[model samples]
Target: MNPAEAGPQVERRNATAACVEFVQALLERKVVEAVLVPQHVPGAKVVVQTLVTDPSRLEDVDPVAPVLMSNSATMVSSLSFQAPKGRIAAVMRPCEINALVELVKFKQANLDDVIVIGIDCPGTYEPKDYMQIITAHGGPISEQVFESLSRGETPSFDGYELREACRICEHPSPANCQILMALWGADFSSGPVIVPVDEKGREAVDKAGFQSGNLPAHRQQILEKITSERSARGQKILEQFAQRIGSIEGLVDEFAACKKCMNCRAECPICYCRECIFCSPTFVHESNKYLKWARQRKIIKMPVETLLFHLTRLNHMVTSCVGCGQCSSACPNGLPVMELFRTIGSTVQRIFDYVPGRSLEEEPPFTTFREDELEPR
Candidate 1:
């Protein structure tokens, strides 16, 4: 269910059942060439990205299936520019959608040929950590847990499976989706399943023969209580964590455990680059340069780019950071990547009074200049 919905109307449904019905509708219309979503891949213990072209293949369409797999925005960027495909109906979390919008503004992706399918952010488990739990449990525990959770049960924190970044997520739903798979905590037996955020999606739903009904009380109460609690918790974390890592020196100290492992950037969907400049020979300057730095400074961090990479990367994409939490998820050191990036990203975005992926018409701050704006006071 979309927690962003105001005044709290609870809508509930068996997300799996809704998925089957939704995919069937998409298949019949053929408006989308394929639906890229998650499903159990064969005998694998983890969920993998599956492309469904036929309605029969939509059996395991668990809308609650967490995509803490790989970042999809970079893949979309590559698909948008390098290999243009037919219209795709792909479900993305808010971060992915927002990252895609940033990519489009930066001329990284072409948005005209894709249909966005969004769902409410019910939080997610980190990929590697989640897989570990699945491995320990002999297989994926997602389906069972989701079913239980859907019925209004809060599951215990299963080891280190939950992503650290998710502990503080604020915006969980994609508000700008053309087609939103609304999951209000309301009883699913009588509420809207596929709520269209756009007219095209509305027409599509109408053609699919869906009828809206009154939301349920039980579902609404669950959503409101949960989201409200989440927001308060997030604010507290911001305040507490801020006290520790609020300055440049403190920031570097917080990142002291990073081991120069570019895992964070590597996992970030917005950090899409076939050849990172830092990874190039230009950064691999003569050996004497390192010695000179060591001679001058007394010590050189082994990975060389201990501070520059993080800072530059933050500067480059903070305006586009969508708070997907994948960076911290992919980190081996468990550094709070989303917390730092989003904290800065939020400031940068607000400077322009912008929210990424919320619109296509809005240009990025770096791309276009105003003739007469932000004049001297």
Candidate 2:
């Protein structure tokens, strides 16, 4: 049977509970050796990724948490790159899966023994904001978020908004995954729809004993609506952002507050370099070289190369950027790093007709050349 045509046959009352049950089944049935999922911390309101081998440890699991503490692609890379003993299933949001796809292309992650169980994301909040919102509500609001998504609406928290990166995300539904817990246009009263995107996903679902059926008729329609809305919004925002950074002076002014902490690079999942050129001895200039630069320019930013750092990074990874916005979140000075990258990335990606993470078969522009491309007659 075509897995894409198969959907969940079981129904449950609670979406979160249903997901927990499904994941637990994966373990109980030995579909995978371990599962990587998000669970609430014992004494804190924050949620982080946890590796579960024992099914009983999944009591605190919340696969659709509204917070993003860190992009999990780096963690996935760490886990799968070394070729672990057994297969694992990772429950990730759409963006994280997309980032992982890019990492696989760069040889940073191996998906051979991995099963990607993707979840639909309405959007996510910065961790601090999520903590505050949930605290004000007196508990987790994941159910409420899922409910909103089922109605094909963006979930809203009182006194807070989603991260700008999420607000402008074009891909809210999972792709390039084996299994998907589809929420868009769902009747969450019956729980999220479990969708098998390929044969592996179908086998996993069958092994876990979930029956097969057809997906919600309106699921694709609603997903397209959401993507269209976000793409239009993203274009508008990126256009304005590009104008703001249109000139060198403008770009420098926007990034003037950078402390050169490298937090953005450190948090970026696509930046897989073991040692960045900026951190090399070449950039550890001698006092005379600094003096020469200062004398030549007559004036230069102290702790120099801040602008250059951003430019160099953009050159290196812009094509692979998934726009997860961890860089902006990681920035202590609050520079709009995500916006800058997406604005430039969209242009460069368009020129090459490439969308990072869209498919494993499509090569990154930098890694491929075309004889008839980008030439002057």
Q: Evaluated with TM-score, which candidate comes out highest?
A: 2
Model 2 CA lDDT for position 281: 93
Lowest summed-lDDT stretch of 10 residues in model 1? 3-12
Tens digits of lDDT, candidate 2, 1-377: 33212311112236587789889999999999999999877547788999999998888788777888899999999999988889999999988999999999988999998999999899899999987776676667778888898888999988898999998998888899999888877787787888888999999999999975457788888888888998898989999999999998899899999989999999999999999888899898888998999899999888898988999999999999999999999999899999999999988888888998899999998887878767672
Best by lDDT: 2
Model 2 misplacement above 4 A: 1-13, 375-377
**Candidate 2, lDDT over the whole model:** 0.88
- Residue 94 C-alpha lDDT in model 2: 85
Question: Each candidate's TM vs. the true structure?
Answer: 0.83, 0.94
List candidate 1 stretches off by more than 4 Å.
1-13, 82-85, 132-161, 188-192, 207-227, 371-377
After TM-score superposition, the amount by which residue 368's alpha carbon in candidate 2 deviates from its true location, in angstroms, is 2.1
Q: Model 1 Cα displacement at 330 (Å)?
A: 1.4
